[model samples]
Target chain A: MAEPLFDRLALIGIGLIGSSLAQVARREGLVREIAISTRSEKTLERARELGLGDVYTLDPAEAVADADLVVLCIPVGACEATMQTIADSLKPGAILTDVGSVKMSVIDQIAPHVPDTVHFIPGHPIAGTEHSGPDAGFPDLFQNRWCILTPDKSTSRDAIDRLTAFWRGCGSDVDTMEPGRHDLVLAITSHLPQLISYNIVGTADDLETVTKSEVIKYSAGGFRDFTRLAASDPTMWRDVCLHNKDAILEMLARFSEDLSAMQRAIRWGDAGALFDLFSRTRSIRKSIIEAGQETPAPDFGRPHKKGRD
Target chain B: MAEPLFDRLALIGIGLIGSSLAQVARREGLVREIAISTRSEKTLERARELGLGDVYTLDPAEAVADADLVVLCIPVGACEATMQTIADSLKPGAILTDVGSVKMSVIDQIAPHVPDTVHFIPGHPIAGTEHSGPDAGFPDLFQNRWCILTPDKSTSRDAIDRLTAFWRGCGSDVDTMEPGRHDLVLAITSHLPQLISYNIVGTADDLETVTKSEVIKYSAGGFRDFTRLAASDPTMWRDVCLHNKDAILEMLARFSEDLSAMQRAIRWGDAGALFDLFSRTRSIRKSIIEAGQETPAPDFGRPHKKGRD
Candidate 1:
């Protein structure tokens, strides 16, 4: 309807985020031709079955050939290797970008391998669920969500504009950020939260006192909230932790220190201190809701079949 | 319709769980008379406005007098004080119970203060939201959820049967467990999950690099799940933390150890280890669904307005 945003676009990994992007892009006519690629042959075959893209391949280079835009959607650890494999095949004036959780390491790893002729804009769409693989994705995943871009100082302005337009066409609100700042923000907002969830779920699994059946049966009370997060794609998250080590370790240290103080207060039976801290955090949830960042639910991990809010 | 289960039932608090119990109990016509008591005058007034109980009182002793059942619904830290105030007023052979998160501490606190004439059966309902106060409750809160009872060895068999019958009247599936085992099970299922949520949110709040706005705005990705648990009533959670210190601390230590191992794997870029753990957990979610412990959702916190799941 609006003269499709790109003539041809390539998506290098067709997992949850990638598939969702493909769906939304198709729905909005963001690209005329979509080229999908993944290292796994099975996944590539599945993508073909789903008719996710016009061209599907196991070769990263062939996927990017003649593409006006290329988005790397693989785990962070595979970024550099994939970049090396596709560098020679990328269209000279095409824009190359990635949907990585951490931006600093991505820029560090893939920027040097890319040709100076192609535009390399690192990005992350702040959207996903615990479910992975192609089938888990949906068309509206990026709607009303933020898509952060971290372009280097030497980057071409035209490329940044095109990338921003592409994201906007995909139903995302795009924002530009510095690479270092982007990594730091995601470490707190995404990476740190994921690590804590994984850690706690692991703790519950190993406890001799609590049988696994009991934990699962009574999870509705509070624990089920963490399970969704702990259920996240571990490979992607593992790569995120390794790539964003310093910020994550820093946040973890701060978390441990705060937890110790809470433990001490609880041990001493200082109800006032514990209550005060807990009460203060209430404002943050309020802020999130007011900002339309979350929906208020009466229960966690359960769908409300009757009420609509 | 079946006859009312009790002539008179007294509730000692009117927070989320208590008020929900009152609403459901009334809607189901489970009791002929409902007497409500809370230490806070304003909360009592609010409960009265909601018509949650037939009789309202600021005094626990007065509320429990001549009642067939007395349920202590206050915070864990207040159990001993409430037990002291109501012990002498309990009708002979009346079923006395509490809805405490940690069972062992509640038993230790209230048992000594209660008279031998009353049958004390402690319970912990495995259902709730992060919300609190009388207004935060709804009628169907306990439906399809587990309600665990921890009866002492000295407790009468008839008392256990009656209490089980009463919970069923309120639409809960009742299960019997020892006090110590209940505490340990809940520590992993409820306490540790909450602690991790609070700690991670605190970690996000204290970050220097990640602006608070960024965290709030992008929370829909995964961080929003933790906020629901973190948003729970501060006083109630504080008491739970203080009362269940030993089990919580032990679980925390195990969590930290598991986190270190995960960190190591991430540093080594071990995708195999990550995939193995991630893949194994998906089955647990499937098990929970098969067990009818969870509902599949289109969005985690949103009420499903659409017909599709």
Candidate 2:
């Protein structure tokens, strides 16, 4: 294997992203030492049990001390507080980054506490399952996935290139974009879809006409597809909604307008309008599959049940 | 093994559902003879090439002339026209049924043409992939899935029981529901989610701020989840919209109201509200999985690229 990229790597929240990072780092020999920390005692203990890192602690400051790289993998809303806790302890030349969905807010929250001597690069990886916590992660989570990095004007070229190399070493294709633009793009691609899914599931759950059991039984028709996104980690999604408020609201508004038009077409039995919109959306998934961004299997390649046929 | 349920079985519309039925009937020995027909000569030819049935024809009336069980696998929009052509030719006491997403609409279209001696049952199998056509099917498509049968009041017990057994032979757990109630339930569970997915994909595509390439690259975040449903057969979905107009509009209205309230919460930065809704939807997927209604794998168990991790 290649020489270790960093002497010490610190992950401050041992959740899905954090655990996956640790697994990938260990598998690829990217870091000589892995330091894991979490606010909750249970998570930290679970990380220790999983042997996700060489050293484990409850104090973010203790984990960051002398580490070459410190990544905050907690909810977006906690970035400011986490930054405040680790500010004094972060190694002088260490590179600080985050795995938050909302980039601009993460920048606004953590940029202030980051020491002048430290390099803070914000990042968001476009990969995950609906599952959460330490047990949900695996080494291959980043494989062929996109990891976007957003750096400020003050960030050094060497630091950015090094971190880019680190992400690439972890098996991610890396891209750089403006923080605000990143937030807006993800508002449509991530936040908006998750929010819509949550709302739809909530709607189905509260319906008086349809029983919850019925909803669950017949989900394969289409509703089950939305439920996976809806089932994502609540704390992370809530933080995403709160942090990227403006962009999410903008996308939701546009989405609402389009839905109203669709509702109108349905109400009026306008086959042409419905056909046109449905036809147009069909090609995008084809493009996504063609670009190798999505799987080509039907129903996400779900395996058939055993002993049933 | 069970003396084959029927001596002659005829299927109209040699698409995904039809091809799958043909394959399953052959695999399970559910019928001694299978006959297939479609409105499109191309599809009929393709079905013939695939050897989907023992006999393939361009005429619906000819297909059902001597069959004991004739399944209408065509779109709901064409049910009325096809019924008009085959009503006189359908053998007396032959059980006629359909596989349509909208139940009440199918019942309304075909009930008028059914003779008193014939039994017509409208079914909607809660199963499918994004792919369509004769080639896009497998015998296991309906395995461990629900096949809802909405039979008319006048239909005999022997007919419903036999059709239920037929679906069981096709590897489906059967359920009976009122046509209107089934329409409403599916409106929330299937129609609304698909419409919302279509609308969201459209909104992302029309964006001036976010490039399509970026959207495609970052789709795994959540948007791609909706694309699978959005990429479904357009003509079938379009016909569903037209046929189930009232129920679909009602569900869309309810969904819009809930979405508006969600937007309000996001605008006001209601963390508790967002968290509660996000958290609540998490269990629905769990229930679906427990009920043997969905796959338990995360992201539907998409496989990683070779030799990357």
Candidate 3:
């Protein structure tokens, strides 16, 4: 049998991503010993019941002690506090990483307090569903999905390679990007889509003309599609929005500007302009499908099929 | 089998909705003969090849002649032109209905041309997917969906009943609604979702930091959900925006206003407000699932298992 990638790994905040990493890492023999930590005893107990880790603890510092790798799996808003709590106990030469969505903010928050001897390589795993918590994750959550690493010039090549190797072992294609660029790219691709979904659902909820029952009843047509993203964990997403403010706000501004132009074309009945823009966007979806980034309809969710990523 | 609903029924556009109607209508013996027509000669030929109808024609007038029911199955933008072309050829007392997304504009366009002898009842089958074309349709497309009728006071009860029975034969539950209310309801439920989807896809495509490949690759995380709606037929959605101007703009404005408030909350790191709104919207999705209007992963392309949908 092949040797495991790490002798011991510590995962702070055993939620969706944390539990998912534990499952996949164990399934792939990526680690021998796993330590799980969370502030809530209920979640810690739940993680232990699920057998997500070999050991579960309530202390982040205790979890990180004697570990070769430590991954912060908490919400972005909780990153700074978790870093402060664990900094004193992080083993020297251990590679520290995070499975956060917003890179720049995470780096800004956690980089200042980390000890120089430990490698602090920040990353965002571009994967997840609307579901949250330990129960929500599975062993194949990162398969075929991109896990981006945003490292600085001062970062050691050995640290990047070790982290990259770990993600690959757990079934992720790795891409290294600048922290700011990562934030911007994700602002458009992930953050904005979620914001739009949440906002639209909120708007529909507030409407007087359409009864909530009617919206629910008739949602199969199109509205149902948005609700899945809107149904994502509120606390986690709230932290994401607050953490990635600038880029999200910029994307929002651009979206509103484009939407106003579309509104004008609709008001004046400019079919040509509306048709042209709508057609152009259709091609992008085709590309996304052709590139196999998304499994297109009827195939993406084959009944009782195993997870792709 | 019961007597046919009509001696002949002409479908003047053989796309997803049109071909699906033809398939169900034929499957249930709802009409003695079906006349299929489209502006595109290739689509007409394809319909003929699929055995979708007894006669296929590229000419709208030729298709409508001698038919007891003439359904305009084309995009909303072409309704006026198709009505103008077929007005002189319509058989007396024929029931004139449409499957357009926008009701008020459709009534305005086609009602003026209908002769006093004919009964004009505009409608919209609240069902469809992003896929288009004749081959993309199926017989069960309308099964268990709502088919809304927007008939005015001048419409005869016999005509309404016949139309309702025809939709029932196509597997839809039928309901009657005022044209304006139908438009507003659809704006919130259907049009707004499509518009927001298109705008967000466009925003992602226009992003500089996120390369197209990166966006496509990471899309499954969240962005791919919107792509299905964004991939809808460009001509159809363009017409929806043009014809449903007031309602779409109203919904867009409301959506933007809510987005601004959300932006402010995120900027201020107001986790409580964000969590409240986000969590509240989550229950609506639950209601939609309970209502059986959606699957657990609604955007997933799989045909939901029996008892799940």
Candidate 4:
């Protein structure tokens, strides 16, 4: 274990990311004391039962009272309210950050509420499983993954360095970008794909000609891959859609236009167009695997549970 | 080892499924002699180098000349020409089958050329990896997967039972359905998902607002899952779209309608609609897992390699 970086680390909203931070911080000795708080009582109990924090409370203000580092791990839509609740109680000179997926809206909503005495450095860790909640948190969730911080010019360099060091301690490679740019990047990479998956699954579910059982039965054909993303937490994804509206809609427009072109190719039986697009996309997957963003094995390298693939 | 089901088996196209049939058939002693043929001479050479078959031929007619069972494992669009090429050479009373994704189209294309003396039973094993070609084939590709056979009343019971036994030997659970119903079912489950995946990847590639490197680096946010299906063979997917046009267009229309509604919800900040859909879809993933169609691991249960999750 390494020396503690902060006297106390307070995490508000202990869901997947929050619980994961608690696990990694405790395991890596990044903080001397971990305080967990959430608005929901049941989730707070679950976090305490999991022993994810040293101090547990439902009051956000109490959680961050003396904390040297405060990380908000709530829904992106809740940032403003959460900041309003705990802003005045933040320790003087404390480094404040967050793990929201949408950075632009988060900065817009929460930055005004933050005090001048505290450093508010908004961050998003580009890592998670489809599963959520305290039980889903694993110590290695951030290992080898990216943790991006969106810090404006007004932010202190010392605050940014400390947060970067904290993320690095949790096994993440840290990168910094502008908040608006971060939102645009994540909208295509994260938000748009999720919305598309959820939409297609809903389409299959609402089909009149096809039975749901049939969809589930032959899902191995290709449908099961989409289900993984569709199975993600509803509250989290809903908030992502609401908070990252402009970028999501912009990407959706482009995606829909592309879909129309693909549909026309199918209608006219343009095999060359379809084949060229499909072939080029295959190379992108290869690039992603080569860059270490994805696994190389077939079927996402699902383990041999019943038999070999 | 199981007793030989056929004295000789002819595979007309030695790609992914054909090469896997060669491996499993040889490994399980299901066929005494394995004959491999492909229109592409380079593929035939690769299959021969991999020792996927005992007899290698460049002619589909030569491959099926004396074989007791003939399997067409080419793209759905190629079935008609392949059937025309091999019709005169098929051994009398031979069982003919295929591993195409689209069943009704395969039946429509190949049935007329088949002699009444031969039993034609179209089949699709609801199993595959995105990777294709001879090198991508493995002996256990069909293990614990479903193989659906679409046989009309004119199809002899004896032929259906034999093909069922063959798939069972390859470690698959066999089920039979009508050809038309099979097309509709696969349209929603396999074809639609594949088309959507290809479309999204293309959309991301063509995006000017977001850089490609950002998409690659932040793919773990959810975009990477679709890339797996998008990486599938261009020629194979092109044929599927062409052969299954009606069903695919129907599904695409429904998918587009649903996507429009979802877009409206996000535009209006209908968090309830988004949350409800997300919640309902999660159960489908659970059902797929419980039905043994998917792995029960977070993040597709991707195996850890050099680093962490």
In the range B82-181, model 2's lDDT, one tens digit per residue, is 9999999999989999999998888888898889889888888988888899998899989998999998677799999999999999889999999999
Q: A179 in model 1: Cα distance from truth in Å?
A: 1.2
Runs off by more than 4 Å, candidate 3: A298-309, B1-7, B298-309
Per-residue lDDT over A1-309 for candidate 4, one digit per residue giving the tens place of the 0 to 100 score: 668999899999888899989998998899999999999889999998899999999999999999999999998888898888898899999999999999988899988888889999999999988988888888888887889999999899998998999999998889999999999999988998898989888998899898888988899999999998999889889999998898999999999898899899999999999899888898778888987788888878865334632
Can you give the lDDT of residue B239 in candidate 1? 91
lDDT of each: 0.82, 0.90, 0.86, 0.90
DockQ of 3: 0.45
Fnat, one value per model: 0.55, 0.81, 0.64, 0.81
Residue B268's lDDT in candidate 2 = 94
DockQ, each predicted model: 0.49, 0.75, 0.45, 0.75
**Candidate 3's residue-wise lDDT over B47-87, tens digit each?**
98999999988898998898998898889989998899999
- Candidate ranking under TM-score, highest first, comes to 2, 4, 1, 3
Relative to the real complex, the DockQ score for model 2 comes to 0.75
Q: Flag clash pairs in model 3.
A: none
Model 4 - which docking category? medium
> Mind giving the per-residue lDDT tens digits that candidate 3 earns over A103-204?
998999999998999999999888787888899878767777789999999999999999999998877789999999888888888888998888999999
Which of the predicted structures, 2 or 3, would earn the higher lDDT when compared with the native? 2
Poorest lDDT segment (10 consecutive residues) of candidate 4 chain A:
A300-309
